[model samples]
Target: MKKLILLLLVFPFFVIAQDLPTVYPFISEGAKYIDREASIALEINILERDISTGNIDSNLLDFGLEVFEYYNKYGAISEDVYFEYLEQSEYGDSWLSCIVPDYVSSTLKSQGNNSYNKSNLGDRDPRTAWVEGADGYGIGEYIEMRVYAEALKDLRILNGYQKSIKSWKDNSRVKSFKVYINNVPVRILELEDRMGEQIISFDDLLPEGFDIWSAEDFEIKLEILAVYPGERWKDVCISGISFFGCYC
Candidate 1:
């Protein structure tokens, strides 16, 4: 009985190991990317086309791509990008501006987190809506990731500019915002939602190496939860993404 139980317990491990593929070792450098600009957003495309196994695991289609800022020679800053919140219109229509064409198709639905399970990390539960929506009745779902740049300057954010975010006024919830310089935590400015076009003030000051007189650090990362409430999930569509900064 003891040996039988042991075999049963180890059997699943073998099964899982068999289920996982070793052919496509994770290519970390190629998988990771950086965009140095005033405002930059990234999109990651995940698919289950394992050339080794003719089978595809649609459930493993979701993954997180982290962003970071480097400072000096030994410091780094990073954060997990999260879904922001959205509100319905006063007339009960889903706020359309918050909806982008890139994520507006029935082919896919947003997966909540890295697990690719139905659970959402933040308030909004992104959809795992059927790949075919309700039309096909029982087909699976697909999803894509999208990020948007919120500014038109040098990708720099000032503490004073966050004052326009509407969520700041509500003391009831913890607004998600973070920043770092050379791995050191920096203060993030909270603002009202209406301050969308506001720019951070540096007074012509850049980081130490940038200009001898510059006081603010030039290489820094500011992270904020961009989507929330309605859902962290995004529908997929084909179109060019628009941002407020120059693209390389």
Candidate 2:
């Protein structure tokens, strides 16, 4: 009887421990041991103030909630590194706008006056998206960007047309992306078909002995390998792409 009770008590813990990697692959296993509640709370407060004063839109608020959800579900350590990255922004050591790529790939001319340019990928507005202009579902199409890789930590992607629920359902979303850093193939990211931001960590992929303070730059490319077909259109869309890191 005592053995049965012990097994019942330990089963859920074992399950969760095994499931963390599958659930939040962006969070490094090493970072799952550090606590950063105070830092996370501070960022939450800043986000709240920004949202209230109209300084920033509610997208950041939703981001904060997602971060809080990570903290809640995986405990304090799960998001400690992320919040640590955010803390640098407070002291001017980092800035959010720095995540915007210096240059983005060209868009197709057939997009017309709707302005479906590649620049929309980093505009921070979910309503806008970068649509691939290619024949037959744009299977081999890709988008590339150039950015300083000094403090780059993680990349966040908002998949599909996010202008409206109807639009999202009508446009294709990426299922697999072959990631390249400085033209060197690095990782293949598998994204979910659902809405909202998907984060991919670059911590483990950085070059050995890399220094964040250095001024090295890299060209990142995301080549679409597969997609979640849309209901109405064959266009594959991506709403936003942002990074989190420390510039200091």
Candidate 3:
């Protein structure tokens, strides 16, 4: 009876280990990806097509090429690439302009000495966040932040805490999300669970470029379309969110 109980306890782990994809061994030096899981995933993702690459996220695809190129002895492109965030060009990184008041009407006050709050979002710290404990799958939760830049070009969102591996998976996080620019519907994207970080490009991508920065109250709103529940907490959280654009 004890032996049967032990087998039952360990069976799931044994099955999970087998069910996991084969982690192909490869090395990279050019693009030091933030998430090791994403690095290995990228290796499997690109190599599956005979190293020819295919329809994948452009940033990930670029990182793969950088690693491939570096491995194949390409130019001196040291630290020129990363998969976790977009390498902003033409202008410096965008700043946290301001948040539209009505959307973030209810601010979650800090608990004890723990410093996770809405204000931390603009502090430029991925370790901090504003979380809501509504119990539901984070639907109806949203943020409308002003993109205060000379030319608001793009938006980037980093879902969940990415300061550490344990913290990331320990809290509920966004899965599918929606975007609104200047109160106008823009796009919807399904985020990658392996420490999601995605950039939405508007220049040349949107019809007539959807330039809303010139508008009086230019705001970018993100709503929780769906969520992935945490292991120990029901609260939905976002580690970091950024705006990339021209200061000029």
Candidate 4:
């Protein structure tokens, strides 16, 4: 019986290991040192094709790309890019804007005199919020939105209740969020306890060969993994969420 149980546990791990691609073995020492960009690009194309044909798992590809990106010291999208786009938008640059999602929904919503529905997340108002109705700190709750993926580059979130300083302090805030793109776990966004907008760039996280300009619309879900407890309230709140992208 002991041996049978051990085999059962080890069998699953063996299957998982088989499912993951051997991405590193494909890169030669010469390719890594001689023409890294060209080599990586070629491998990415081949991997993408295999993924599309169901020959390789998408998650495995993501893991492989992340390893390469880390070794290459590729950085996430910078605030400067966001600021530059903002400046251009002021001068009739209609190509880019804060995208309001086509649909927004939450697992639970707190009932109150004022509305605390999912719609509040995209209203662009820090004063209003989507509060989780769950008991305690509302861990494990989630909010999801669907938006056009074309040129989608960044995600902006205003964490916690922001009606007033008092309100912000009275309600709980998200400390970490597990972000999922189209139901595949992508990144975990760790937020500061302080009040302000937090930006998350997709530049480093998106799967290789995913053309944001041509892909169909996709869903993004943010699951609350942890929270900064409030002094007075058990409910957790998020003031707003906005997507930065170019329509063209």
Candidate 5:
């Protein structure tokens, strides 16, 4: 009997120890939830006093609550508040929060300048492809890429292949490239014109109803394609890239 009881206690500890690290704790607590069909509403508000002056006190803004509504097993309705956090604002005369439309719209366009390029490749260099680099190499460099305040923004390639080439025999052409945004893969432009600069604008390709990122933190990734031989990817050059927008 003692052994059985001990096994139960030890088992629980082992399970918790293994699962604890993977489970992200909630900043604020309420009812537990699953991603069932439900509605999530986020809001932000600014006090009139804070906007009266041209300068805004970041301390005076309210971030608001994250709410979720769903139905219980018995068909009963339920609503809960999940987490609490303070929203940040720009230094301006008017106060603003994430809930406002203007704050969300600002992220729609390219904001500032940030660039990424593949280093020059020598005649017979193996590191000519788009693998993560050391000294802040390409892949797995950061868990998340973001732009906040007066800092460099992360730039992502639109796709792996911008165009198709028939000169090479079959699959000899560079098929894809990789870029990371906020530690996640978001865009991938296929093979295109390799000689001249090709521009990619993300606003045109973003998913419908996907609101512009209002928070200071966001994640995205990009992939570019490279071919071998005369058109070896090593010969290509990515001058630079950038991002711009107000993060609410």
Candidate 6:
């Protein structure tokens, strides 16, 4: 009888520990929610305040309750008061998070090892690359990705065939290029003959006078207009590529 009573008493602690709701990943949006439970009011209030001031270290007591001060605009700030959270300003999911390789293509193939083909561009590994094989460093050679994004805001390119620190500058790097969406020319970008990743960001990818969002079914083309070839090789290469914003 005593053992049964002790087990019942100990079970609640285990349950509490296991069920403490993680108070993270809350979308930063000014949205309100209502709950029937009064015990949770204080916890919500404290968390809401901390997050607003860029404070993430809000304490959750042993009771597994986040300590936050609730403020009620309509009535007394009580446990039953409705709460609001930060609203998300940015639209769409992360571009890199959910992108699928639609049609990542390059000009030619490396005859010896197909591993360095254009298909490897979306693999996210910098070691493998989309390299123009025996074709040599052709200025017009390009690496085009058929991107599908909700709102394309940022484009990051790990330029060059960077298998090693020494090999990074050993290939033709993109010096000037044109950006295309769905085969429609949008903008042209010129990058320095530099090693490492380069980013092209857009505040509003939508065309002028359009408020909705950018096109989702996009054919993003990175046509090599000019290049700075490496010391030894004359091959054009792109190591990695990633887009930002939500995927369609």
Best by lDDT: 2
**lDDT of every predicted structure (CA atoms):** 0.25, 0.64, 0.55, 0.62, 0.28, 0.53
lDDT of 4 by residue, 1-248 (tens): 99999999999876653343211111112211123234334555564455445675444444344332332353332333323323332322123343444444442544566788777776545577888887789888887777677767777777788776677788999988766678766566677775566666667545556676777887877778899999899889887777666444
Residue ranges of candidate 6 with Cα displaced over 4 Å: 1-114, 134-136, 204-214, 246-248
Task: Give per-model TM-scores.
Answer: 0.21, 0.59, 0.54, 0.59, 0.28, 0.53
The residue ranges of model 3 lying beyond 4 angstroms of the native Cα positions read 1-109, 204-209, 213-217
Candidate 1: which stretches are off by over 4 Å?
1-176, 203-218, 225-248
Candidate 3: how many backbone clashes?
0
**What is the per-residue lDDT of model 6 for residues 6-116, given as tens digits with 9 covering 90 to 100?**
999999876753343211111222222222133245555665565456475332222222223333233233432322221111233442532334544444645665467
Prediction 4 TM-score vs. true: 0.59
Give per-candidate clash totals: 26, 0, 0, 0, 36, 11
lDDT of 1 by residue, 109-200 (tens): 44464222212211122221122222332122222223332222222211111212222222111122333334333434342222122233
CA-only RMSD, every prediction: 24.3, 17.5, 18.2, 18.9, 22.5, 26.6
Best-to-worst ranking by TM-score: 2, 4, 3, 6, 5, 1
Q: lDDT score, residue 106, model 4?
A: 40
Report the C-alpha lDDT of model 5 over 117-222, residue by residue, as the tens digit. 2321111111111122232112222212333423222222211212222222111222334333443333333433232223333453333344545445444433
Off by over 4 Å in 5: 1-145, 148-175, 178-184, 223-237, 244-248
lDDT of 4: 0.62
Model 6 weakest lDDT span, ten residues long: 21-30
RMSD of 4: 18.9
State the lDDT at 178 in candidate 5.
Answer: 39
